[model samples]
Target: MAGVRPRAVVADDSHFMRSVISDILEDGGIDVVGQAKNGRDAVETVADLSPDVVTMDVEMPEMNGIEAVDRIMSENPTPVLMLSAHTDENADVTFEALDKGAVDFFTKPGGEVSMEMSRLEDQLVEMVTSVAEVDATAATGSEKQTSAPTSSTRTYVENPTLLIGSSTGGPKMVERVLSELPLEADFRVLIVQHMPDGFTERFAKRIDSRSDYDVREASHGDRIGGGEALVAPGGKHMIVSNYRSGRLRVKLTEDPPVNSVRPAVDMTMNSAAEVITDPLFGVILTGMGEDGAAGIKAIKAVGGRTIAQDEETSAVFGMPKRAIETGYVDDVLPIDDIPNGILNTAKAEVN
Candidate 1:
């Protein structure tokens, strides 16, 4: 037991894919204890093997990855990393799997079968290894809320700009925070959620369906408007351009990735700090890295406010912890309380 490696179950309908994934895991020091040909077999194999993690294919015969994720979460609750194709349809299904409790996802190189997957060897191994450390039960459970903070008097900043960044367990958290905001709040929001190119559009659509704010994927030269939110397109950096007609516009660039991810929080937040002279808010939620730390400092240097999701509620505390360490975060609140923190920061009377 002392020398035992973390075990995983690779589930895919393609025998070739199963072998490839198993080999990758083994090479990464993770033991592939079992393999499954379909979702049904995946469930049964997981039950029997009780592996530390699972790499699940999005599409399969006799059951799909989404269904398997639901069953696993409800029953065993092991960490699941989804393998999906980069298509509009697969994006929707992959999000469904995430909603059903998948820890994270890796976009397959070129559809269901491709030797191109070998190109993603490093990324795949990293994701699977990181996910195995997650507490699947906590990651999938409903968030607990606390009462909002209050003071005697209230003030507000009209038409404030809100910049949000997140990763890992971010989608559900982002949806929750945005949905809790008042429909009439005068905020121009820009969100940078670490995601793949084909997925951000659908991600924005899903958020818009449940949120009161007008949400859509950001396009180049898109003018910022109060009461609307724009999600940065994946695989590109979104930065604030010059102010025009009393509003700032966002520009998408193919610049090199920051912090190893395009559309990084720091990229957007740093740009917003330089252009937007209004009251700005930088919020870093649950994520696995220190992407937003410098952005937090940038915002605070310009007399803007910053908030971080507290570790107790964070699915992974990496980003928030790094931001908090900068001593620039004005409020550290739970996931449920974060919406209030953002709104309250704008409303809290200036001394």
Candidate 2:
């Protein structure tokens, strides 16, 4: 591992956060090439140092993370990871950073930024190291431009559900796909994104701000509506279940982990299989593990459609590749083609 050390630039407004992130990076076999106190400094540092990865703090002063992300992506185009707090406002800004070009994000784990550092070392290191593998093309948002949906009256379907799952390299993948989709679209979208506790609510809001759909985090017993999208909360399992109201609703449970994660894609898909007698569709995107393979198989068994992100466009190629290998995926598409792929498939499948 001697010559394999990755280099990184750490950017954050909080002195304690910068110190903490830097320390974690160093301990994880990455060289701390530079440290910047604000967003402008982050952009400048990336240009000067050209580190393998950049960690951005979302609420930084001078230039916020979103601005720095745009500048760096437009100019330097390095793999950037953003840091977000548990606060609701920061969640919107945090995912906005991802949409602008930040690779992924991590939440400050504890309720307070206490002296506890061991809680984050492994997870932070793994994410930064995994993220460092992104090529300049993806960091610059290099997927081909797809036309955003123009004026349209989306006819709501009687039984339509879209399921999406992603992990590493997911934030941007999900954001881009959602942004290209018709705002106020006809179907319901459910997402199982691997994230720490307290982040998904804001992530949903961020996607909501950028799209026509009413995107929000799922709550127990919340029934998804037409033209609505729900993201599974961080610490619970989100399952689709039938309510007494004779419609599908989100059920958050404290169930044991599946595929080593609480909000596992397989769990949601399997649960959906039980409650949904409709046109269920699963779109599996980039991530590092085989978390969605079983879920895709489950969906396919139920006669639901499935799409896997192809290897060429996937950042890690692990999760989608596994799903594709299952022979359950009906389509394997690049990131840019996914939105249209889903739309066409939904129209063809749903009544």
Candidate 3:
């Protein structure tokens, strides 16, 4: 009862919606510090209250969630959790909010609050708790650093292949992991991130600008190489196939959606398993849903090394949790330690 209790502000146009969210947070043992009726009020309240987290709604009077998120991030830098409607328009806005620094989002369930509240309550609590922790750590700037993976001392074939999957917080997570990796690391990394068209290109460009690695939107027939990262283009499925020269190359197609997602984690993971049979390193990072669980199982079945992001360090624990629960993960690591794990695993194969 003594550790830091999170203070959160709820922002929405409807009083009833705000009340429902406040109730959910309070039930989760988080303190409801304040409430706001619109984006403008939310920004003002956040500036004044300096709460640990802010739950913002996308459509509001006087201002919108994207503008409010930009203002909040620019002025105060507090963690933000966007409440988005379940629609394509809202999804687009949600991604924009993330690019502007909002940490995560929850899709507001349609229909009666009483009926859907129970279903969404857990998700709400999860987002609030995780974002609050991140906010507190950011404010103190004293978060404990994660330890890097040590050499395994095992020897294997040195054909290193990288498989990465991400969703909600993936752009940032992937960027951080790829940036921290050594520039000369010998491997080809294939990234499958849940995103819509027009966003993957921008996301890849952002990562490329921040990292030493050559990151780009993956193209059909693009040859995988060392010191580069390939992002699966939005709206397409990316697979790995063997090249005539025996190197793994990317194969893009308009395959039927798997796991309710086109460019799903399972598709990419299964494809990587087929093409890279030796010493594969598969990683499932922060995201929503169980899309990567099957893929991780496939990789593990083939003797590949598999890793999942620990729940405590993930923005959303759905994907990683599923993979971990399925017992497919060889290691469950914090986000910061993931890059080092990949390096250590890759190094282990070469030794």
How much is the lDDT of residue 16 in candidate 3? 89
Q: How close is candidate 1 to the true structure, as a TM-score?
A: 0.93
TM of each candidate vs. truth: 0.93, 0.85, 0.69
Task: List the candidates ranked by lDDT, beginning with the highest.
Answer: 1, 2, 3
RMSD vs true structure, all candidates: 2.6, 3.5, 6.6
Q: Put down candidate 1 lDDT per residue, 1-351, tens digits, no spaces.
A: 456688999999999999998998899889999999999999999999999999999999999999999999999999999999888899999999988999878889888886888888888887787678778988767766543333334456776889999998789889888887765556788999999999999999998997878999999999867778999999999999976444779999999999999989999999999998888999999888899999999999999999999987777788999999999999999888898888788884578
Model 2: lDDT equals 0.82
**Which digits, one per residue and each the tens of the lDDT, describe model 2 over residues 1-351?**
347898999988778877888888898888999999998999889999989889887877789889998999899888888777767677767767777877788777652253565686887888888788877565564567697554363443455788899998887788778878775446678899998666787678767877778899899988876678899999899988873332569889988888878799999988888778877889999987789899999999988989999887887788999999998999999898999888777653235
Better of 1 and 2 by TM-score: 1
Candidate number of the best lDDT: 1
In terms of lDDT, the poorest run of 10 residues in model 2 is 148-157
Residue-level lDDT tens digits of model 3 in 187-297: 677889887666677778778887777889999988866667789998899988773333568889998988777799899888888767666788999877889899999
Superposition error at 190 for model 1 (Å): 0.5
lDDT of each: 0.88, 0.82, 0.79
